[model samples]
Target: MASARLERGVVVGARLLVAAVFVAAAVPKILDPAGFAAAIRNYQAFPYWSWNGLAVGVPMLEVVGALALLSGWKRQAGALLLGGLTLAFVALITSVIVRGIDIGCGCFGQSEAAESVGWPLLVRDLGLLAAIVVAAREPGPLRAARVR
Candidate 1:
């Protein structure tokens, strides 16, 4: 019984953490789309035509997924979506490092001095990815206890 409670607590905690990250990331992007677009352009990962669309779309997706996670109605789907987003971010950041392009992470809103891309960012994304995966895989508290 205690183990089941603990598992539920952990899952809930992970969900909240992931949701908070998405909300934090989305708010800045939503508030300053132009700045986010500029940062995306700096990545040079996408074509010029796609920048505007991506800048708008990504944040909206984050907001929706975050809300879903919080609501628990589509938590698994949200976890999958956010996990994919984190993976894409990790890939993009890694590419920036490999290509030796120095640019702001664009994770938050525009800043006079944007945080540069580096391993730290990659590690952070990876950690988020791990959390998402763990949450996704974890059965609900009742189900988990039954399986064990």
Candidate 2:
């Protein structure tokens, strides 16, 4: 019973942590989309026409996924979306590093002092992916022990 209780606590913690991250990342972008759009443009990954669409959509997606994670019934779906987004971020960051395009990662918003994409950011995103995975998979119900 104690173990099961601990597991439940950990899972809930993971979900809250992941949701918090998404909300933090989403808010700045949601407020200042044009700057975020410029940050997307700096990536040079997507076409010029798509930048505006991505700028608008990505923050909304983050908020929606975060909300879902907060809702017990929709947690799995939320985790899946957040996990996929994290993976995509990892890939995108890796691509930037490989191509040697040094620029601030437009993750939290288009701040002048934003951190640049590098191995550190990739590792962070990977950590987030792991947390998302944990949040998505809740432990099975505990069974009672029987004695002879």
Candidate 3:
């Protein structure tokens, strides 16, 4: 019984930690929509007009996902969305690395930085991907083990 309780606590802690990271990342983009648009443009992921839409929309979705995870509301859906988002980010960063594109990650920044793409960014996203996958799959001991 004690061991199960400990495991449940650990799982919840992991989910909270991942949720917190997403929330923190969203704050800066929320503060400067225009800057985030420019950052999205820097990725060259979409057409000119679409960049603005993506800039505005992506962060908002992220905020929603973060809130869902934090609140443990519709946790399974939230975790799935978070996992999908993390996978998309991983793919984007991988493409940038492959194409030898030296640009600011702009993940935390509203605008580009005067730095080059490197292994660290990929590594970070990979870590997040792992966390998202774990959270999605497990959804914590308490939630999973409870009577349905």
Best by TM-score: 2
User: In terms of lDDT, which candidate is stronger, 2 or 3?
Assistant: 2
- Cα lDDT tens digits for candidate 3, 1-148: 5666786666677687788888877888788878878777777766898987877777777878878876878877887788788888888888888888777876875444533556898898888877776665453445555753
TM-score (C-alpha, index-matched) for candidate 1: 0.91
Whole-model Cα lDDT of every candidate shown, in order: 0.88, 0.88, 0.75
Model 3 poorest 10 in a row by lDDT: 109-118
Better of 1 and 2 by TM-score: 2
Which ranges in model 1 have alpha carbons more than 4 Å from their true place?
A: 143-148
TM-score of each: 0.91, 0.92, 0.85
Task: Estimate, for each residue in 39-86, the C-alpha lDDT of model 1 and write its tens digit.
Answer: 999999899999999999999989998888778778789888888888
| Model 2, C-alpha of 84: deviation from truth (Å) | 1.1
Which residue runs of candidate 3 sit more than 4 Å off their true CA positions? 111-116, 137-148
Question: In candidate 1, where is summed lDDT lowest over 10 consecutive residues?
Answer: 136-145
Clashing residue pairs in candidate 1 are none
Candidates 1 and 3 compared by lDDT, better number: 1
Per-candidate alpha-carbon RMSD to the true structure: 2.4, 2.9, 2.9
